[model samples]
Target: MATFAMSDQLLVIIDPAARQTDGESVRIAKDVLSAGAAAKVCLPDGPAEFARALGRRGSRRPVVIGDDHALLRAVTLLHRERELAGCGLSVVPVGEAGETSLTQSLGVPGGAVAAARAVLDGTERRLDLLVDDSDGVVLTGLAIPPARRVPAPEPVASAAGRWYRTLLARTLPARPPRLPAVPAPGPTRLRVQLDGETLVDLDEPLESLTVTPGAPGTSGGGTAEVEFRPLSVGAEATPLRACGRTVTVTGPDFRYRADGAVSGPVRRRTWRLAEAAWGLVLPS
Candidate 1:
């Protein structure tokens, strides 16, 4: 890990989503960052402009001011250019709490002010990455079968019932306690292999599969945790788990979710762990 000085040059790329979602937070982030460093701000309107701004950054450190998607975009670009290992990326998460969960999971501070200050005073920590065969990068973990979508509830017919429900909602706490929805299992068959050894065969029905990159301070440099649940017959079967450097999946066309984005209906896919493939700035 390496600490950054206040005099360092920074290229601050503010995502358009952040501006539209929370202008005040973005402004505060800009104020703090500019006050502490030699910062050049870029307000890119779309994906093309965003890539251009990042590509044009010379010796300046790149700092992203947006949600997880923006951060993923920056990392993916740098990884594609083979510059991710050398560049230390910083992010100021700006969006709904759920939307920025990936950034938080990677140890970034929550608020705009705190995250911005970290950019000036934090240390650069090397992080692991999972790169797929298609050149897709996964900053965080990915799920084999994408989450199922639940339809919205039917609207009430009576206006009086609607009013009563509205009143009940208002009377409850800001976030009323509710149990997490358990997704009903669907029929999915996938052949999973770890490090070239088969973990599960195509004959078995798979309920879910997940792959996550190893954390920073772990012993192995290039390794990821893999877990998958086999659909049980009478009783719920225990999920099989393993840690390895590479994972391969083959079966019928299936979609997967990586870093909150959905992709593929491809028949086969493989991912290999890249040890210390990127750097992220985090608080000391």
Candidate 2:
């Protein structure tokens, strides 16, 4: 650890995966931070190193230079370390603009330089997170029962998929949008219980299911909600929200995505939502 002079500043953690860009992100980010204010930046090797950096200095605001996924990682780490409330987090997104800029929706921005600048002046606000007391901490999103999109085969596919998706984005509208491709066929049904009360037990095969925290513009409070929509023909539907501290969902083996990343083929799972668990630094 490097000795530091006391200053109103935050610790910056650059994602290892972001390093695949050969430090361009970090360099630009550092320059941004230095330009905006006096702060120290610590570059870590990987996820473990990032978390360790946080463990050592979570009390300080954390500004991550990476994608929304990295932001998710930070949130999960805060939850795991049981230091969610005391820490404030910020993010600088890098990657597919559409995909990466989603972090901006959380108050992060795309440019490393601009993002770092925001970190210096960003406002701290409480945010909601989904915590799986058993499996792990969920930061972004999750897929629950009634839909099994097993990602096909990820070995050579994920990259190819990204390339193809990127290429498609380049030709299409400059506006961000998900590919209009139809949802994958096949569905998995799930039974959901919120705060110990059964809310849904349906046989409808779902194309996808996701839960998002209440946004800055929205005021739902510490309420956690479960939404189910049939994927065979994916479309938005009225979602089910629960005001509870715990959520339990179980069914036959199913695939789930937590915070954009996939999680399980497990049959039973539970999520505990702790409200105002962490501080998020958003654009002001």
Candidate 3:
């Protein structure tokens, strides 16, 4: 394990959500970090400021005092700049348990004191990242048939407006009338390809799909765990699981949730693993 001294200069970035949602946690994190090192704190109100804070970082190692989304945002920004590999990140996750699942899974402590202390006393370990063709990056996991985004209801027509529309309809030969959009169906059919072998083809309807970073020995941390459940009427079919460096999914337009953020509706998407592309600070 690679270690760094506690006296290293540190730049701490506090996400607005964390400070707004939990002020005490932020204070605790600041106290913990300052006690061990020369620490400077920056409060970024929005995404733009967040990027500026990271972009302007000097020799100080950057640490995030926020939840999973904040951590992902920082990582994504660094990835875009091609500096992720050179910069080792530390996270003192400050949010509700449900909101910081990714940090917890990565072995970061959930409590403020423990996580902050780890940030100062931890060792750095390299980790893999999932890069998509669209230039999006994922840290933890990706799942399909994302949580549906309910559309706002259309405005109702007033009595006078309705009457006017009716009169206009009677006077003019209506070109094909536009109808409201129908929602896409749930439990869709998807064709999944792992590395070059087809796992679930378009012929089979799928209930759901998940792809997570595989363990170190599973595939050298350069492969993802791909699993899909088949929709069936009888007993539930056993899910199919495989690992590969690249995973592709296609079939009618669909969306996916990656690291808690929803993206897509495209007909096809592919994610390739970059082995140990970045380093994370964790308790030794």
Candidate 4:
């Protein structure tokens, strides 16, 4: 890995969503970054332009000014191009509080001003990565059988308001709305293996599964933590847990949520832990 210097040139990519969501934060980040060091700012209109801008960054350290999705896009592109290990990335999260959780969890500061300062005056920390067979990268963690969401109940209105709404509904022409198609049920039986050893078989029904990268600077030696809950008839069974460098899952077809994105109905998938695969700039 190359040494990161404070005086190095920076390529700042401002995602469109960041601009649309919070212009003030974007402007603040740009101001702070520009005042600190030499930076070339690129306002990309879409994903294609963002990729092109990042790809063209020659010697400049890449600093993403957007939300978690933007950071994921940058990292995924570099990983796919085989340039991730050599690149030292930084981020100034500019989005809703909930949307920027990934960056925050990775040690990037919350506010734009603080994160921008960290980019200029912080050290690069190498972090582990989880790479799947499909070439997808998971920064934080993933959960099998994506979580289900219950819709919120309709809000109650006052009597006069309800009466007015009833009158308006009778007067206005009603059009049949196109309803969303419901998703099919997911696979229940899955075979799980860790480091070439079978942990669970298809005959055993699993309640849930989760996999996460080892904590930074830990003695886990670049292994991922895997845990699964088994469905029991009478009493709740204790969840099985293990640490391994590789994990494999085989089933009819299952969907998983990783790092805030849902992917795969893949019959089989394997993920390998890449020890210290990438670097992120964080406050010292």
The best candidate by lDDT is 1
Residues 14-38, candidate 3, lDDT per residue (tens digit)?
9999998899989998999999999
TM-score-superior candidate, 3 or 4: 4
Clashing pairs in 2: 141-259, 146-188, 146-189, 147-188, 207-231
Please give the range of 10 consecutive residues that has the lowest summed lDDT in model 4: 146-155
Candidate 3 minimal-lDDT segment of 10 residues: 214-223
Q: Candidate 4, residues 186-207: lDDT per residue as tens digits? A: 3368899999999888997777
Tens-digit lDDT track of model 1 for 1-284? 88999999999999999999999999999999999999999999999999999999999999999999999999999998988888989999998669899998898999999999999999888888899999999878899763565544454456678788788678976654444655755668889999999988899888889998987433235789998887764227666789999999999998899989889888999999998888899988
Compare candidates 1 and 4 on lDDT and give the better one: 1
For every model shown, what is its TM-score relative to the native structure? 0.85, 0.73, 0.82, 0.86
Clashes (candidate 2): 5
RMSD of each: 6.1, 9.7, 7.1, 3.8
Query: What do the candidate models score in CA lDDT, each in turn?
Result: 0.88, 0.66, 0.84, 0.86
> Higher lDDT: candidate 1 or 2?
1
Screening candidate 1 with a backbone cut-off below 3 angstroms (N, C-alpha, C), the clashing residue pairs are none
Local lDDT at 137 for model 3: 91
- lDDT, residue 215, model 2: 54
Model 2: per-residue lDDT, tens digit, 1-284? 01222255677777876767546777887787766655667778887788788788734656777777777778777776777777777777876455574577665666777776667766666677677858487555466545323443223235577878778668876654343444555566667777788765657555455665555423338776666555444555555444566777777777777756676677888887766667766656
Q: Tell me how candidate 3 scores on lDDT.
A: 0.84
Where does candidate 1 stray beyond 4 Å?
A: 146-185, 216-220, 232-237
Stretches of candidate 2 above 4 Å error? 1-7, 96-102, 145-186, 202-208, 216-219, 229-245
